[model samples]
Target: MPVNPPQAPTLSGDLLTIHRLLQSPTQIQRRLQTIQDLRFVADKILTARYRSSGGAVLYDVSEPIFNTREVESVAPGAEYPKDVTPEGAAALAAVSKWGQATQLTDERIKRNARPGDELDRVLRKVVNTIIRKVDSITISAVASAVTATSPAVDNWDVSTANILRDIETAEAAIEDLDMGYNPDSILMSSTKYAFMASDDKIATLRRRETTDNPIYGGDIEMLGNLKVIVAPASRLPSNDVWVFDSTQLGGMADEAEVDPGYTVGEMAVQIQSERIARRDAWEVWGRRITVPVIQEPGAAVKITGTNP
Candidate 1:
């Protein structure tokens, strides 16, 4: 025999909403904790100091604007060279807009929160999220900078010899720019990292074996002189790789808000909080402010479809 199931209880509000219905002086809320990836890539190449919020245009000379001089059997003390060739100079500028993120907290809820640093931790994570978006925007700029005249992006091989060969070829392209360029960093996606790590050719040469330790993410450390960094999937695509000189690279220009703490860009603004009897809501607002423009594409070398 089945008795009528007691009617399920109905909540006056949804889990996402917090509206006070009782006159209780205190309320309690609990938050969950989780691990998040922190491998941000934009800072690696697009240095923060290079970033500007005043809407300044970046200007730089184009690489190899002048032809290399050819050496001919010169006559002893060739009658004082008539003229000297000057390296052509070109101006560069980057146009930037803004990227933003915001969060609203209920005052009543905050006051009654449990005795812990959870709330502060949550807010810190919000700030980090906004910065990561900047990284994504930077990578997009680099990818779009690709032009028809840009050096070829090759597909790498898995064998040990091929790996060294490809890396050399990629590095040489920038060094050959005759523009005094040297690749100082290499950025890749996790998928590519696994592909390289599993290569039987390099594995055979390994004198010691190591496994990934979650405390610190798996990293390649270095490949030749370039620092090997695994960029978040959001910033780097799985099939592509980029090698570039950090010295010549420019990054986001932003200022930290002293009173508060959010990074201020051209689009930065303060958001006010609202308070009413048992309810209070505060807001944070900002925007991503940087554009990646390759002033000298020659300094960067990208390879595509290595896993393929």
Candidate 2:
């Protein structure tokens, strides 16, 4: 006789148990949706911090100064009648206006500009939604586990590990979730060139050694950790060398003791080069990973016209 077909797994006390097992795939999908939501929230925060808001730009103002003067002069008087006349001179006062160069001053007005309208309320709503979604997914995953013996859901329980694993797997599955686009290398290169140009101008101003002192080099090299001694080259009683970075020159040619004529083009190149280096460092260290979206579950749900 043919054996009876194996009986299907029977559901026990609560309807939630049966519905949960049937909806496992849907639960995973929801978890991924939550992750995407979190990513969006993170992007908003980054944009708010990094993106510029068009704020007020102010111009410098000039003020004028004036001076006042008084003078007294005597005129010959005929009353004396002896070819010499004594007369009281009237006091005279004069006002004159002159233009003088003065330091320009500016006051900046504080701006209350915001990146987006109602940003505070929007941010609060986004934060609350993320918290609720994360909590709901976490709680549901734990509560539906087959091995759970109590009403309370324990997220760390081994029974819930599979759900957690699925979430991890889902996150790893996405391949296009970068938070920000990579910056252009050409822009970075230009910045580095500018930095180098500026550095060369700095090198010219440095004092040259008339006689050999430990601190003096024929030409300054832009070595990273080079130092300069403040003490005069001839007066050092001991051979002590106090060193300082070339940056201490503070962009003034007089301070560096070099002749004028450091071209602007050269300084521009150095500044650009330095900027490029900084950008490169960011490109290496600040890169963000993008999570790929697995469209299978969403696709299946779409095709079937069902929640799962």
C-alpha lDDT score of every prediction, in listed order:
0.51, 0.22
For every candidate, C-alpha RMSD to the true structure in Å: 8.6, 37.0
Q: Per-residue CA lDDT of candidate 2, range 157-195, in tens?
A: 223323223222222222122212221101011222233
Cα lDDT of candidate 2 equals 0.22
Worst 10-residue lDDT window for candidate 1 reads 21-30
lDDT per residue for candidate 1 within 32-88, as digits (tens), equals 112234334666776535444455545453545454565456688676434356543
| CA shift of 118, model 1, Å | 4.1
Top lDDT: which candidate number?
A: 1
Which regions of candidate 2 deviate over 4 angstroms? 1-117, 150-308
- What is the TM-score of each predicted model, taking all chains together? 0.63, 0.13
lDDT accuracy of residue 239 in candidate 2: 21
State candidate 1's TM-score: 0.63
Instruction: Give the lowest summed-lDDT range of ten residues in model 2.
Output: 299-308
